[model samples]
Target: MEKNTILEQLRAAKAAHINWVQRAKMLISGFKMEEDAIPVNSTQCKFGQWFYSDAQRLNGLRNNPLDCMSEIEKLHFELHDIYLNIYKIYYDLEPQGFFSKLFGKKKKITDDSVKLAKEYFASMEEVSKKLVNEINLMERRIVALPDTDLETL
Candidate 1:
């Protein structure tokens, strides 16, 4: 892949990671402010279920044989790795997602992580936009190249 394309991919993946960080914060806040934001009313309301599901899907696809991996697969792995790394970077900011903690004296770590992640993303977003512009310029150059005659080969 081209350097600009790779940068674009990184930007997109980072944006997504940043988005999730915000979402996690919102969920955590809801869990905290509400008396029962995540009640046992249904399996869908269980945060653990969604976390496990996401983690499972990510791990399963990421562990595939290297030889069999396609560009998209590699991108997925790269994106997943970026997210995992960012999560660790701000993981300490998130509070334990437990009902007792949410309603009790515990502060929300998710909110804190999201705040920091947003700043990180904002800076990276500028780089991503620049990369996209670079990729577009490169594509224009490729398009301007002379067409080869396949029949002459």
Candidate 2:
């Protein structure tokens, strides 16, 4: 990929993550969204898709001593781990009786769980900030490389 193309993809991935955090905040704020809007798995999100697919092939992001890709992956997983806690708080995922499933019934989420979810959200936000920083650091490394290096990506 050309340097500009790679950079553009990076910007898109960053935006996806930022939008993801915003959507998560919106959910915590009591707005209803499509269930799939905020995926619980780190690897399921758009940013994760891009990071996993493109990071290894990108010149500066892989096979380098100063590579922070692993750190980025760790932080991304931590963010999702925190989100899983919040998701559990908002949903009663235990198996339901056949009748309940047939009727499309769900166990009601409790107010206490809502409060707990907020606490988890705060933790997720912290991890998200670190993830973004690592991504920025990776971007700087990419930009520092000569155009010749970028050409091979």
Candidate 3:
């Protein structure tokens, strides 16, 4: 694949990851109070799934440029676990009538969920930043390759 093609894919993944992180933060920030407002539901689960999906994509992109992909893949799995944990918590909260039980009519969340979301949010943000930085470095290397070297590929 062309270097730019790979970079573009990485860029798109990073963008999606950032969007999810922002939405998760909103959940913690109380901007989204209704269970429907949260991104963890079936039809609106993009933000929740982005953590796992982006990590996988990042691993594929890194294999061409990084020597130690195993470590990177481990990091991705860690993030995926965190995402799944958040999803699990939300799933449990649903049957309890979380919207009415927590905040009367306001649909407030449990303190525990807030705490977990914050922790995972910080972690996902850090990982996404690191992956984007690595992708940038790889792009620089690709661009600096001599024309003859490019032709050999």
Best by TM-score: 2
Backbone clashes in candidate 2 total 0
lDDT of 3 by residue, 1-153 (tens): 455654565566556556665665676676644444435432234423543453234344332544333443454455555655655544444555665567654433589877887887788778756655654564575566443443323
Ranking under TM-score, best-scoring first?
2, 3, 1
Highest lDDT model number: 2
Cα lDDT tens digits, model 2, 63-101, are 563368889888999998888887776655687788876
Candidate 1 lowest-lDDT run of ten: 38-47
Candidate 2 similarity to native, TM-score: 0.87
- Candidate 1 ranges with C-alpha deviation above 4 Å: 1-85, 89-108, 149-153
RMSD of every prediction:
12.7, 2.5, 6.3
Better of 1 and 2 by lDDT: 2
Q: List the residue pairs that clash in candidate 2.
A: none
Q: Which residue runs of candidate 3 sit more than 4 Å off their true CA positions?
A: 31-64, 68-71, 93-108, 146-153
Where does candidate 2 stray beyond 4 Å? 59-66, 94-106
Cα lDDT, all candidates: 0.39, 0.81, 0.53
